[model samples]
Target: MLRRSFLKVGLAGLAAPGLILRAQATEQPRPGSPFIVTYFDLPGIKGSRDVTDAGDGTLWVCGQRNGTLGRFDPRTSQIKVISLGEGAAPHGVVRGPDGAAWVTEGGQNAIARIDDKSHAVRLFPLPAGRERANLNTPVFDKKGILWFSGQNGIIGRLDPNSGKMEVFDAPRGAGPYGMTRTPSGEIWFASLAGNYIARVDAETAAFTVVDPPTEGQGARRVWSDSKNRIWVSEWNSGQVSSYDTESGSWKGWKLPGDKPRTYSVYVDDADKVWLTDFAANAILRFDPLTEGFHSFPSDRAGANVRQMDGRSGEAWGGESGTNRLVRIQTVKPA
Candidate 1:
């Protein structure tokens, strides 16, 4: 259904922002819009910070507070919870190339790997003498090395085959939160406190810092499109920004409406940028091809989706505050 909205343009004084405001999803999906959203209500998990596909028709999630790993099957819409043993405040979970859910355990300052099929858990603790790493997210590069971020200002990599580990100090020394590997195999990370995105050389372990135009933009998360541009969710500035690696240029747009704090960002298979807006309790989609915006408000208030990712035209995320996992499918009818 096509719906009309009186948007108050905040940036240009057209009506309302440092950003342009988009219309809310006042009605269900239009006959032509390419999305069919679905939700799986996962009970009994708190602070489901990050999620990833299990590669076997399931999604793996990290229960940050409950100190457990969660698996949600879209087919059955049922949730299976696995304890990470004692001191397991896991923050990030991703399915590694080895076919296991690799997690950044914040409480124990370690990385835990859970077998996707066996549901077995194994912990890989960080080297000692480092203060709590405040582990956040993990990513696997093309070379089969596992990289992870720590909000407490550290980045590291683990070789699953040799069981070898290496840690590096972030240049800014705090807030290395969310990360992604580009199509070029280089790793890029967003430092929420540092206000910039840094590119890491996977082989050499060197960093080249790239700053956004906005001061204190609070780059919370990062993702890459098919073109290899880096997309970032700006928490403090309430914007979504991207850096084109080829051009070395930057572009950004503020979230729709006033004071829309973006908590997470993801680029789907179609390269449409998606973000979670805490202010509206909605998921926002930006069509780069048209330079237009669309909002998908949740059925309930306070979805508070922290991290999101998608593959195979299916996007999945957790309602950190609501104890649920939701999926959005982009359907183009035949």
Candidate 2:
């Protein structure tokens, strides 16, 4: 029996209620700060999480609660929501090289792809007995292969062109979460329950586990810097640590709050580290040079920005708990 898939394209150019204009005044900038923070309310897309640049001017955000993927236009404050099918609770989305939104659709136990132009939906079910992989995040490698992690101890890869996929049981069962591709073309992932990060061998589909210095650090998410260093969000330790792949050395810094709950980490073009702390209800910008952190607390309480991805000047995150999307624009220093 074959699985069924469906697509529902929303009326375009329709502005959701309470949509904040891009030019509107945002949270007041901190003293000598170069970041302007703004939030846009996504009324219908409940539990907006994991966002990626659509390659055009818009962004692709997953509606984890609503089973939809949204294309948000910042300039017009308009969104076109595409349903991923019934019982589709998507955890992460990434814009594939083919210009479609590829999702880790956990609820339906499949990988979904939503075309950028036609909004066509496609589903690729996992092989037999791989049910409930608990798909978490997806990333495209330099070779255009889509790699994803599952909290249920699985790492999988898909060849977009061939529609072929391979899944492997991750070492230390039950916690592969966020994943990223390094500048050097290596794919790495964080194992939250396993308390470590691992580099994926693209060819053999094998994992090379690299342990963090802190035991039980809960390495939840990972992002690769331009230099190929793996920056990890230590959920259990409330610390942001980076492993220098070249030197094989690690450095970590604790978050600001007395009890921070670090959730996500993203490395921008300038190498600035962006992190979210659920305890502080804030997004943090870390400067590796100064070794300091600048906090940007959300205007609304409990704004849980789960995952972040962006372009050159803008950093975007989905405020999952608040049902909103947030963007922080940074001005480059002269």
Candidate 3:
């Protein structure tokens, strides 16, 4: 495994010449000793992009290619699917405030909420008269209102209580992808095309951009630690960067391998950063305490585990390439 370290990046690429931190290191991929991986077959539900807790032992997933939302009980290996109607290419699924699965439906050009049991579907179209939005992922703010991203250069908020939905254009367009709320309750999202992550002011719907250290390092996904610092996965540069919100500093490390393609990032309860390397076809773990990278390669080939979320005990992932939901139980090394 190869590693690179850089810190104290200036905002908007404005700094003394050659002041940017640049160094590289290597790490060996972790073998199958301390990790126990189990997979649940999501039969017939292919192209899963994201997963979220169903508020039960089960998990809800987006069947991106099949135009459906699926609920899978990992304990029993039972899966239930609900058709979001034709042309409903759902991209992200998260449990909503009402204890239901909310979907960003790009195919239907709307936001959808589905009952956990009855699976009844309700569509909330992007503010009236607007063209179809290339919807991406969603995250809820402290007030229970939903904030979402659209790859078509847009962001929006939905008030479930009042059925009021509004859309706003991102500062830089056409790449608003993954989104996560900070511990301080601020919502931030990544701009894949724009190469920056921006924080959203929920009340005003304002976006403030945070640039990554490396130019053209596609900011594909963003997650926050318990301390409210933002962690972002840079797709183009194959690195993970952290923004210390309080100090206004940045630190970044590249994923191991010659051509690591970082697709998703999640920070678990233990403060360990989890990432999916598409090029290596494995889930990589980064321990902040040790500043080391560990790899947990999936047993099945091409287990493209995109978009994961952490819970109290474990982290869940949707293996889109294999059409399965995987739960990883890691034994901490002594």
Output the number of the TM-score-best candidate: 2
Q: Kindly report which residue stretches of model 1 are placed more than 4 angstroms away from their true locations once superposed.
A: 1-34, 332-334
Per-residue lDDT tens digits for candidate 1, residues 50-121, read 888888887887878777777776666567777776667988888888788988888877788787766777
- The TM-score, computed over Cα atoms with residue i paired to residue i, of candidate 2 is 0.91
- TM-score of each candidate structure, all chains considered together: 0.88, 0.91, 0.88
Residue pairs with backbone atoms closer than 3 Å in model 2 (clashes): none
Native-to-model Cα distance after best TM-score fit, residue 188 in candidate 2, in Å: 0.4
CA lDDT scores, all candidates in order: 0.80, 0.86, 0.80
Where does candidate 2 have its weakest 10-residue lDDT segment?
1-10
For 1-334, candidate 3 gives per-residue lDDT tens digits of 1111221111211211111111121222446557656666676576877888888887788889888778776656666777787677898888887898888888878888887766778777776444676898989999999999988888888887777777777876689999999989989999999999999888888788988889999999989999888999999999998998889899999898998989999999788899999999888889988889988777779888889885765777888887777777665524
Off by over 4 Å in 2: 1-32, 332-334
| Superposed model 3: Cα runs more than 4 Å off | 1-32, 331-334
Worst 10 residues of 3 by lDDT: 12-21
Reference-based lDDT, residue 312, model 1: 77
